[model samples]
Target chain A: MIQVAVCGPRDASEAERAQAREVGRLLAGRGAVVVCGGYGGVMEAVAAGASGAGGLVVGVLSLSTREGANPHLTVAIPTGIGEARNAAVVNAGDAVIVVGGSWGTLSELALALRSGKRVVQLGGWRIADAEGAPLDGITRAGSPAEAVAATGLFV
Target chain B: MIQVAVCGPRDASEAERAQAREVGRLLAGRGAVVVCGGYGGVMEAVAAGASGAGGLVVGVLSLSTREGANPHLTVAIPTGIGEARNAAVVNAGDAVIVVGGSWGTLSELALALRSGKRVVQLGGWRIADAEGAPLDGITRAGSPAEAVAATGLFV
Candidate 1:
């Protein structure tokens, strides 16, 4: 009954793209809708994998002018908010699954922090300062499977 | 020296991809560092365009586990936070530009609104009113030139 939101770099590297797809498969196999920024890289890979299994995929786009939605997306929630569309993803997910990322990834982590949502970091860079003020309710997993499993157990 | 972030669905249709690439070129020619989810679709397009023009591009990635960074990224800020990466994108940009989208894009949009970032929707849906309250300073543009102009004027 919960949706798993996948967020990552739009121009993800090969390995990142592969990881995202695997994660999507895992989520879809469990019958969760896959949500993402929705154009390419990690987002597209995940959507492609999930949709291949007959899973529903949602995309919240930021195009204010002419950009269009990804073809893999089943539902498109357009937010005329420009790049701020990131907020909707963090909020929509019951649990957050992160794959390969950059700055956008960090912000989504922050959103999870702000929302008190369950956050599981897979394989990427350490964005927060654990030594300083550790994030509350955030758990770090060694792999994608571990990350998704924690969603059922943790938040 | 303001940074502008752009993102969208990864598995974009041909039309979305073309539009994203054009947006990337426009952003680069204007001398702005285009930030993105950092892997594919609009992220790669914007980063390639900006980097090619000697402009700066930063990618905030979510792969703390093992995913790699995009080749076009000049500066990669890996968060290892996974889907929460959306929050990072909204936080990093000085201003925001949106184009085609998905769930992650919506999350970014929500984060931008919460952060009070000025956003210019480019070619997708307009930011909807939340609980009957409209965003305070969102701008609408129909073309890349107008969108960029709006970002400049709004910021």
Candidate 2:
């Protein structure tokens, strides 16, 4: 089964949240497992969407306790490792879907790109250097469906 | 004994590398223990400096094998957890001193701030928000001594 990691900010815009939820729902509908940071905001939204669709959801928690994870998760891996859990979140997925922008989210994107994971950026800060050169490894998705489609999970 | 964490890019500038070494050396001179990511670059330089100063060093390695750690480490923890080990690096230190900037280093700083750990920024990016407001939680230091002093380790 395809495992897709969805990441975003904890304090996100309403539209961003909706988009995250939609992405989760679509991934679940495609018979793909959803993996996330296991906290609130985009992570929670995606997990909620997948769970609502009767899909498996895995939350890679920063804390050692399962209680830190969202109730929607099918499995909560309490890493007790803090933001470092971002690597675990990316490593767990065959592809990564980033919804919003944050420093931690940026780190995950960088790690995913470094590891050669298919990254579908829905709506987030474009990773660029001082020269404003965009990291071309990331594929921009116009919508939630497009994001999941970019992951090539259906293929 | 105080445990100080020194972080920077894996491919560091010559000056940045020297700064890391000095930080380690000073920490060791003050009877403090040095902790780092334990792979290479700044970690290696700091570990070498501390070991050369007859100080104890701990390397929180990302791999499961001890061979992946710098030989200067007194104790190598092969977590085999990849970048998730950054959490382990920050969590292991009483205070953190960042030498240079990188995506991984930025993640560690964010985590350190979230954890309420005293962070001394010697020569790294001043983490700011969208409005360009600097994150005020971090203290700026002019030199290695000042960074360690800012941690209240010498106070």
Candidate 3:
């Protein structure tokens, strides 16, 4: 099964949360396994959406123990490596879908791009070079549907 | 003992390689454990420097086996998780020092900053907002000595 990593912030806005949920549902509908940070905010929202659709969701957690993992996760991997787990979250995905932006989310985005993975961004932060030129290789989407389509896994 | 992460590109310039080696030597001379990506270029340079100084060096490798690891490392952890092992490299360090730039190096810098670890940059790519303002939280250094000092681990 294709694995899609959905990344976003823990302190996410309501709109971002909704978008993440929709992205999760859409990924699940396409029979993709959803991988996420497996904590709160967008992670939980995505897990909930995938679980509601009866799809498999993997939570690559920062905590070594499963203490704070979202209940919706089908498999919880306690990495116990703190924010470093963000690398694992992106690594597990065949493609990466970014919802909202945060420091942690940016790390995952950068990691995914570094590894040459297909990345689609929803509403999130913008990164540019020192001259303000936008970094290449990231596709932006207006909605969750577009985000999933941008991954090019289903099509 | 303090564990400092030394990060840089695998395709490194001679200057970057020299700088990374010096950084490793300084960290080891101060009785700190050196952690690195465990491959070629800057990774190999740092590991060589640290090993030459009779200090402990831990190579957090992406491959599951130790096939490609540098010969100078005291310990090799074959994570087999690909670029995801970058997270473990940064996680093992109390602070992170970046010697040069690459997509992979940028990811480690971003991950280290996201985790609130102190980071020092020698010569690398720059990240900024869309408007060209530089992102905060990264300390810039002109030399390997300055980079090691900036980590604040020795003091």
Best by DockQ: 3
| Interface quality of candidate 3 as DockQ | 0.40
Candidate 2: which docking quality band? acceptable
lDDT of 2 by residue, B76-123 (tens): 999888777887888889999988766677667766766778988877
DockQ of each model against the real complex? 0.03, 0.25, 0.40
lDDT per residue as tens, model 1, A50-130: 887788899877775326666788888777665556667777898888886455565565566656777887666443121
Residue A19 displacement in candidate 3 (angstroms): 2.1
Model 2, A1-155: lDDT tens digits are 78888988888889889999999898989899999998899989999999999999999998889875778899999988667788888898999999977766866876787678898888776544323345368798899988988988787
* CA error at residue B35 for candidate 2, angstroms: 0.4
Model 1's lDDT to the true fold?
A: 0.70
Is model 3 an incorrect, acceptable, medium or high docking prediction?
acceptable
TM-score of every candidate relative to the true structure? 0.50, 0.81, 0.83
- Distance from true position, residue B125, model 3, in Å? 2.9
What's the lDDT for all of these models?
A: 0.70, 0.83, 0.89
Instruction: Identify the superior model by DockQ, candidate 2 or candidate 3.
Output: 3
Compared with the true structure, what per-residue lDDT tens digits does model 3 show for residues B1-155? 78999999899989889998999899989999999999999999999998899889999999999998999999999998878788889889999999877778888888888879999988777776434467789999999999999998877
Ten contiguous residues minimizing lDDT sum, candidate 1 chain A: A126-135
lDDT of 1 by residue, B40-141 (tens): 776776677778777788888877632556688888887776665776786778888877654456457556755778787755533322122333565767
Q: TM-score of predicted model 2?
A: 0.81
